[model samples]
Target chain A: MQQVFGNKKAIAVFVLPTLILFIVVGFLPIVQSVYYSLLEWDGFGKGKFVGFALYQDLFVNDTYGIKFLNSVWNTFYLAILSVCVQLPFAFFLAHVLARGIKGEKFYRTFFFIPVTISSAVIGLLFLSVLNPNYGVLNIVLDQLGLGSWKHDWLTEDKTALSSIFLPAVWQWVGYYMLLMYAAIKGISEDLFEAAKIDGASGWRMTFSIVIPLIAPIIKVCVIFAVIGSLKFFDLTFIMTNGAPQPATDVPSTLMYNAIFRRNMYGYGSVMAVFMVLECLLVYFALQRLFRSREEEVAR
Target chain B: MISALRTKWSNVVLQFFLIAFAVVQLYPLVWLVLTSFKTNLEITGSNVIGLPSKWMFENYKYVWVGSDLARNFANSLWYTAITVVASGLLASMVSYAVTRMKWKLSKLVLLIIMSGLMIPVHATLLPLFIILRDVHLLNTPWALIVPYTVNAIPTAMFILVGFFSALPRELEEASVVDGCSIYQVFFRIMLPLVKPALVSISIFTFLSAWNELMFANTFINKSSLMTITVAINSLRGLHTTEYGPIAAGMVIATLPTILMYIFLSDKVQKSIVAGAIKG
Candidate 1:
């Protein structure tokens, strides 16, 4: 025991692989992104230290500043809309499915199918399906009496970003449901029986009993959702390509296009740095708020 | 009795709603498979709504060759293999070291490792690019391999540490008394035991690398070197967009994941359940 107790070298050996990778890839890049933010470089061109000049470019100029605003707004807008819609729907639907409600296995498997499919595939399918003239959606609307509701969803500035949200929500809801449902399922059945004896209706039982118990899980779920949405990339990129002339841009797409296309790597790094801060702020704030709320509830 | 019948009818209605949802969940993938058989003119002129008239396996063949998805799959397979083995081993090691062993300094080490999960790549892409450039790892497999492995540590370590901590330590201590080294105790003992955790780590790493994009998109600019997701995204740009080849490529791309899911559905479901279990 004494021999093993002081074996720091062996312990370090065990820890070395991951720790080194963390430093090389994870830790260093963060410090480097901030450093790069202070310079002017076009990747191939020489970098000049401008001392926060790129930030000046970000705020003073309409070009970068406005694009950043559109991106941030779209990201959070999608996040808010997703939480409001997906959570309650997944919660209730999970409750319904969890009740040994016939075809239970089928329903569970059914919802989870989309999750195995990648966001890229979902984006591709929607891009094709939401085609303005010949798409399935517009065609169905034209068949109905509400032909006036027909509009170009993906290409329109007003609807493009929001248009991608449905597909994102569709792919994700089941994944979250599986999380929430699994949580609800783990709750003891005696509670449900007790609620029934108290004359609680199904909806009431769900609201009072299941909701409170799963609140912690839901908090984590919402955190995952919000942080994920804040940094969302692939689906938006593929689906809209920031179409309708930059109206649909999210921060990631902005960061990507800035770096890849224009080669304005320095200004792009500033935007990237801000994105990191925004996520940290949102995450810490949510966590702090949730912690306090839990304490209050306990009291 | 009437109320009982009404309740049964409502349950049936709910079942029907769920079945319809299952179909809607499936419709796009169904279309992709069916349309792979359709001709270019068939896809373009006809609505992308239904089954194909003829079964054509050639779309798969053409895409495998023409779009170079076979090469992309090869790249993805290697990426998945390295990431799963290397990351899983490293994460499992740290998990054992921190969780089971009594080390005062390990408390901080564990916290640092777990907190790494909060670091999203978009936050650090610029810096990562510079670091990779400085090391000349840009456009190399090392660029993808190192970062993907690092990014996975927290989640995989979190899962494994929970699992290892829950393990009864009596057997391990007995092995220690029998003059077994830690390596043998882990390999001859705990390694075989944590099969499920290993599976969980491997599958998670496989899926993560298999679906990885942002880094690959930024780093690997070479045509032959792109991973499948990047390859698929670039497929449209590499040539004219032909529905057959695109559908074929998607089919090829999707098969490995589907096969893995089919074989490991129970294990995968268990992992998700385990995720919910701890929370």
Candidate 2:
């Protein structure tokens, strides 16, 4: 069996092409990014080794540092809202839908619709929906006799950040809901029956029974939400291009402008490196935090 | 009786909330489709949320004829097709080798490949630009296809490996004993067994490659080679306030995905779950 299954030529034929492609296209660029992050150069021509000055500018220079840090903060803000606001709402929906209501599948089918559509389309959809003069939002506000509530959603600094992010956050609520719904559904009916017999209400079952049972999956969702927030680009680019630069800019958009627009390749690579590290750091830190909590629960 | 009444009332509220939330999730696509049919005047004036007074079929005609969107749509279809097929085939081969075939470095190779999931694709953009430029592949469709297919490998393998690992060893062994070669057993037997996994992963790969924007935008400078997302963006650039035509282009770009979901919601949902599991 080993001889037949492990034909050397066959294994090479099966694996080598994918391995080489992954290395060249997927892995090599990451290594090159790390190398470029250490230099000071435009995208074209020769690059000079600058020994982390580019990275220092991201942290210490007034113009670059301020914008970069603000971008980082905005990205973190997204993660915070996704966990605090979006996930909880998804949980609520998943909890209600898990109770075997009529049209449960019907509701779920619609809820997941936005997830299938492109972020570009979603961005454009929200762009028009928030188009100030003719937008549905302002028109509705007017109909409700609250004309003062209307503002240029994507143009104003105050609303632009939150407004652009609303669609991004909204797109994935169904996703996390579906994940948590599946996790909650995996809980045995006997446990729920026991809770109900003890006179525990639906809210009580949710807090005491469902939350604890699905804690691991919830932790995974939180991590996913955070890392995904750190990588957000398309919608931000489409809606505003991080206009009012440091105000609404997230990391990817900032990096895009730095490298692609301004030819600041080295500084841009610093942002890129920072993003990759940020994702990894958050992922491991969350794992450690979740693991420790699990241990505490065991005790 | 009073407790039962409380339960029934709460259920009604819950149902109402679910319906409202579903409408919120679904309303924008509804709006986009409706906005596509309206004239610019109707869209901007009296009918932001109602049926168009004059349904303008010209918007679709404009997108289909007036711009390079038709050519761009063809490019998108061609690129997405190749990506789906290539990623599917390559992922299956790798998954089979690692899970079924005995190899010394299989585990290590799988680890390196799966790690690609964590490395955000955007981080590689600068370096990829340099690499592709040096190789003279910057403006070609291969620029997007190569990276898209490669980026997809990790998620595809993550799905396929589980299915491949679950097949009983004796099934393959029996085929081997019948004098079938390893290649034949893999291609003729094992591959067929994992067709369901292949279908789900292919759907996911198709959706992602179709909707990809940044790489398509940055790598392919020529408008002729641009995908629908880039084309639509350029269209938006050229016609800033022509919401009717822009909306029509968006509708055309999103129609395939929406239609596919209507037909295969279960498969789409399952594939999304499979993709998210990698996270």
- Which candidate number maximizes lDDT? 2
| Model 2 regions lying over 4 Å from their true place | A63-66
Query: For model 2, how does the per-residue alpha-carbon lDDT over A1-299 read when each residue is reduced to its tens digit?
Result: 77888799999999999999999888888888899999889876889999888877788874554467888899899999999999999998888788788898998888988888889988888988899989888998999999999999888889889998899888999899988888888899999999889999878898999998989889979998999899989999998888866678888988888898899898889889989898989999999999998898889
Q: DockQ of each model against the real complex?
A: 0.58, 0.78
Q: How many Å off is the CA of B15 in candidate 2?
A: 1.9
Give the C-alpha miss distance for residue B98 in model 2, angstroms.
Answer: 0.9
**Model 2: per-residue Cα lDDT at residue A220:** 79
Report the C-alpha lDDT of model 1 over B1-279, residue by residue, as the tens digit.
997999999988887888888877787788788777887766765645667776778888887877668887899889879988888889988888887776677888888887787777886776777778888989888888888889887888888988888899888888889898777777798777788888887777777678777888888888677788878777777656587778777777777777787777767666765543432
Model 1 sits at an interface RMSD, in angstroms, of: 2.0
Instruction: Indicate which candidate wins on TM-score.
Output: 2
State which docking tier applies to candidate 2: medium
| Chain B TM-score in each of the candidates | 0.95, 0.97
lDDT by candidate, in order shown = 0.79, 0.89
Model 1: per-residue Cα lDDT at residue A111: 84
